[model samples]
Target: MDSSSPDETAPAADQTDRLILEVARTELGLGANGGADGDLVVLDDATGALTRAALDALEGTQHRVVVQETSVQHALALAEEHRGALGEGRLLIAGLEDAPADLATLLAGRSVHLALARLPKALAALEVRASSLARAGVPALIAGGRVKHMTRSQNEVLAEVYDEVHATRGLGKSRALVARTARDDLRELPPRSSEVEIAVRGMRTAVTLSGIGSVFGGASADAGSLLLLDALDQAISAGEIEDTTRSDGADGESDGAPEEARAATPGEGSPAVLSARSVIDLGSGNGLLAAYLRSALPAARLLATDDDLDAVASTRATLESLAADAATSDGAVGTEESVGVDAGGRPGEARVLWEASLAGQAADSADLVLLNPPFHDGAAIDATLVQGLLDAVARVLRPGGQLWFVHNSHLRYRHELESRIGSVQQRARDRRFTVLQATRS
Candidate 1:
C-alpha cells in the first residue's frame, strides 16, 4: 500500500466522475492553490478512474485520499493497477466487521472531511453508504451518476442522513447530489426481509430471506431464481439429477448412474431427495438460493460467494435467520445445524464467502453450482459479465458436474453456456426467464 507517483496514462474520469470530482472540490474548498487539511473517501468507483483522477488532482495537497469499494474484485484492481498512485493504508473494504486497525484508526474521529461516490441505484445502498459517512462524521458528500439513472428517491435517501441535500444541474448527461451537515443521530438502514416458497425435501416450505440495501433485489426472491429452483426440483424428481456425494474422490465425477430405487423411496407425489455432497451458490444474493439449498439438500455442504461485501453479509444473515427459525419450529422444516458454524468453530453445513468470481476455488471441486447472474453493471446493462461468470463456474465444476443457471429470457445465454460449459439442457423457460442446466465436460 505504499504511495508512488501516479501512472502518467491512468484512465481518465468520465463525465459523471468528473462532475463528482468537481462538486467535491468545490464543497471542500480545494482551490487551485491546493491547501486543504482533511482526508477524503471515494465510494464504488469500479473503474478506478474517479480515484486516480482524484489522486492526481490532490497531488501535493494537504489532504489524503482513501477509496472504499464494496466489490473485492474492483478493490483489488484499484490496489494493483493503480499501485503507483494509491498510497499505503488508503484503501478500505467497507462493511467488513474486522477491518484493519490502521485503516479504522485513520477513518476514526470524524477525520474524513468529505466523500465522492457513484450513487448506487438502490435507495438502501445509497442510504447505507451515506449513513456510514455521516456516522463517521464526514460533513459532506458529493455523489454523481448519469442523469437518466438519477431519481428523486436518491435525494430523499440522502436527506435522511444529512441536514441538507440538493441536486446539481445536469452536466453533459451527468448530475450530482450534494449533501452537507451530517446528522448526529443518523440511523442505519435495517435489513429487509421476505419469504419465498422452495421445495425442501419434497415439500413446499417457506424460507425467510434477508438483505440490506446493497443486495440485489433486496429481500425479495428473484423470479429467475424461483424458476431455476422449480427446474431443479423437477430434475431431481425425475432422476435426471442425483446427489452424487462421493466420500473419497479427488475428481468431481459421479461414477454411478440413475439410482432407480432411491427415487421410489420418496413415493409418487413427493420430489426426489437430492443428496449432493457439495453445492456452490455463486452470487448468492440475500442467500435465497443458498437457503433453499440448505433446506432442500441438508446433507450437502453449501458454499455461497458474492462480490459485494453487503451481499455476503446479507447471505449470512438470511441463512442465520433460517437456522434460528428452524430451532423454534419444533422439528418442522430444517434443523439448527443446517445453516451456521458448529460450536467447535468449524463451519457447519453452510458457509458464506466474500470473493471475486470464485477467487480461490479449486478446479473440479463442487458437485453442483447454482447461479442467477445479474446482467446489469450498476445502472447500465452489461452482457459481457455473463461469459466471465460462466467461465469461472466452469473451472470449479468437476467433470460431469451440473451448473443450474437462470437468466433473463432476452439475454439468450444458451449458446454461451453450450460453448464454454459442456452440454446444455433447457430445464425451464417462460416468457421472461430461462433456466438451463449445463453439465461440466
Candidate 2:
C-alpha cells in the first residue's frame, strides 16, 4: 500500500515543518487518518508520496473502499452496478479525467459524502451537481484536491452552494481545498433569466434563458442557435415562410370555412409533403418543433425528449394546452380530432413524454430522430459528447430511419457521424448552420 519509500529524498527541515503545520491547522479531517477510521473511503489512481502514505494509514479500516479511476464508460457501469450494494457507506472516488455525465448520473441517486479530486473538469461538475442537489435540499459534499487564487465571485458561488468551504495551505508547489455540505431546509428559488444576443446572418437575434448553463452557453450556442438560424433560412428558401400577395377571390374561398375544413384542403403551391410514421424531437427546446409536428402529422405519433426536466414539464403543459384548443375547434370533428399522437401509433392521444440522456437510449426505438446535439462542454468544444450522441442515435434509430440534426457550419460532424453510424448527407446548409440528414444502413 505504501507506494513511496521513506528513503526517498526528504524535503528541507523548514519545508517539512511548514507541511506539518498546514496539514494540522488548515486541512479539514486532516492530522492522523484515525478520526473517521472505517467511515471514510479513499479513491485515488494517481500515485504520490503523501497520498500513498495516506492510503497506507487506512489499510485496516473495514469501510474503506478504493476504486482506481479507469475508462469513464467502464467505471460508470461499475459504479451503477455496485451503487446499491455500497449504499451510503461508500464514497465513489474519481479522478478529474472521469466523464461529467457519468459522474452526474452516479451522484444523482447516491449520497456522496465527499468527492476528492484535482481535475478542473471534475471540480466544475461537482460544483454544479452539488449546487443542484443543495437546491433540492439534498446534502452533498465536494472537496477539491487543489486550490489557488480564485476570484471573489467564484468563492461566493462556492459558498452559496456548499455548506462549508475550506482552502488548504499551499502544499509544496500546489494547494488544496475542501467543501462540505450538511442537510438543510434550503428553499427552492426560481432561476434567473437573461437575454443573450447572438449574431446570425449578419443580424443579432436575442435569446431568452431561465438558466445560463451548458444547454444555453455550450451546446445550444453551437447547435441550437445555428440550427434555428439554418431552419429559418431553409423555410425562406423553400417558400414555407414566403410573403406573397393572394387574390381577393382566393381569400374568399376559405373566409368562412371551419378550421378542420381549412386544414383538410391543402393550400395552393404548398411545400413538399413530408410524411413519417412518427417524429421525435430530441433536445426539443421549448417544444416548438414538437408543436408543429403535432399539427402536421395529426396521424403520425410525436414524441419529444429532452435532458432538461423543466423543459419536459413545460412541453407537457404546452402539449396539453394544444390538445384542449384542438378539441374546442369549431370544425365538425369527432373523437379522432386530437392533435397529439399516442406512444404506439394509437391516433388521437397525447404524445408520450419521456426523459432520457443521449448516452443511455435503447435500440431501434424511433423512425425519425431530430436533434440539436450539444457540441461543447462549457466554453471548450467537445467532439466526444457529439460522438456519444451520434452513437446513441445509431442505437435508437431503426434501419433506414433518418436523423435530422442541426449544427453550426464550422463543426465537422459529418466525419464522426459517418464513422459511427453510417453515411451522412447535408440536407440543408446556410450561412449560419448546416442540417444533416443521416440514415442507418
Candidate 3:
C-alpha cells in the first residue's frame, strides 16, 4: 500500500531464466498438470512476470496455489492474473510487506515452494523460510535463477548451513541452487556475511563507520551522503541551521558555536526557526548517515530507522563502534541522555519497519530528517517509494523543520520538493547525483 524503489534493468536473457523458473515452479508442486492442494509458493523479490507462467500452468479447477511477493505492484498484478482463483480463494496474491513474518505465518505447517531471486537478499529470505517451515516436516523447494546474482562460493556458504545443498542442470544462462533445510540446522546455523568500512566527511573531520549484514547494494561511503554532508557542514559552520540544543523561550549561549546556535528571537521578516532537538534518519540504510549526523550534531537526539532488519543491525553496529571509538580517543563522549543504545546493542536508537516512511516517530516533533530515497523497489525501478518518504517527512517534520535529501541527478525531485514543502533549493549536484534542502513551511 505504501511505495517502493527502482527500475530493474531487465537483462537480455536466454531460456535460462524461464527454464530455472520452470524448474523451481515444478519443484514446488506446480506440476505440468496442476499444483497440489494447499500449496503456497513464496517468491522473494518476485516480479509480476515470473509468477504468471506458474499461474497459467495450474489447472484452475483442480489445484490451488497461493503466491506471495514482496512488492505491492507485483502482488496486484499476480492477483489480476488469477482473478477467478482469487475470487474462489483457490489462489491468493499478496505483498510481503512484513516479509518473513507474513510468509512465515502463512506457511505454518504447510508445504512451501520459495522462489528466491537476487543473490544475498535470497539468503535472508532462505533463512526465514527454512526456520519457519522446518518444524512442520514440510519440504522446501528453492530455485534461484540468474547465477550471476550469486557466485558459487556464496552458494557454498549457504550449503554449510542447510542439511544438503545441490545444483540443478544448467539452464542456458541461469542455474538453480536448491538447499534442503532441517529444523535443527535452521535453528543452529549462524549467519554468514561480510563487513565493510565507510568514511564520510563534509566540512568537518572525517568519521569512519562500520557496516555488517550487507544489504542495499552493500554498504559503502555513499557519494550522495557526502554531497549532503557538504551542505550540512556548511549549514552548521555558517550558522544557517537552528541550534540543536536550544529550546523555545529558553536563552541560549551565544559564543563559539555557529550564530544559528546562538540565542536570538526571530526578526519580523525572518523565519521562525526551531532548534533541532530530535532527528530521524528516514530510510537510514547502513546507518552511515545517522552515524555522521550524530557526530555532526552532538547535542541533538538521533534515531536511525530502516525497513530491513539487516540494515538496522548494520547501522546500530556502526553507530556503537563509532561511539565506542569516540569515547576512548581523547574525545568527549556524547551525552548518554541524547545517545543511548537500543535493544540490539546499536549505540543509538534504531527502529526497523516495513516501509521507508517515518510515521509516528519523534512523538511527531522531529526537527530534522535526512533521506536518500531508494529508487529500486525490490527488483524494479519505482519513484513512489520516494514519494512515500516525502510523505513521511511532511507528516513527521514540525513547521519550520528541514529535510535534507539526495537522489540520482535525473530523478528531478525539485518539483515534488516544492509541492511537498516550500522553499526547495538545490544544495549540491554532480554528474550522477543531486542534493536538495526543503523546509517544512
Best by TM-score: 1
Descending-lDDT candidate ranking: 1, 3, 2
Q: What's each prediction's TM-score?
A: 0.78, 0.50, 0.58
State, as a TM-score between 0 and 1, how close model 3 is to the true structure.
0.58
**Which residue ranges in model 2 land beyond 4 Å of their true spot?**
1-26, 30-84, 87-142, 145-150, 161-165, 172-174, 179-186, 192-362, 374-388, 411-427, 439-441
Model 3, which residues run further than 4 Å from truth? Answer: 1-143, 146-154, 160-163, 169-176, 181-214, 242-273, 327-354, 361-364, 377-384
CA shift at 287, candidate 2, in angstroms?
7.7
Encode model 2's per-residue lDDT on 1-441: one tens digit a residue.
Answer: 122233243322233233433453344353354533332222222322223333334444444333423233333433444453234433343421232222234344433223333323333333454465465333323333433334334445567666776655556644444455743645433333444444433345454333312223321233453455455445434533211112113222324643223212346666322224445777654444455445444444566765543344344444554565566442111121111223353332335332344443346655566787666776798867776667777887766566777877887788877776677777777776788877666
Candidate 1 lDDT by residue in tens digits, 146-173: 8888889999988888999989878899
Error of 2 at 229 (Å): 7.5
Model 3 / residue 56 / CA error / Å: 21
- Local accuracy of candidate 3 as per-residue lDDT tens digits, 1-441: 101211244223245446656665556545544444445464543454444444554555444455544433445445554555567655655333222324445555555444434334445545544444454444544556665665676556555455677777777566777766653644532333334333333334444454434445444667787777777777765555544343333333323534333223354676445466567787776666887777766556576766554555456656666667677442222221111123121223333332335533543467688998788866788987788778778877766678999999977798898888667878889998999988777
Better of 1 and 3 by TM-score: 1
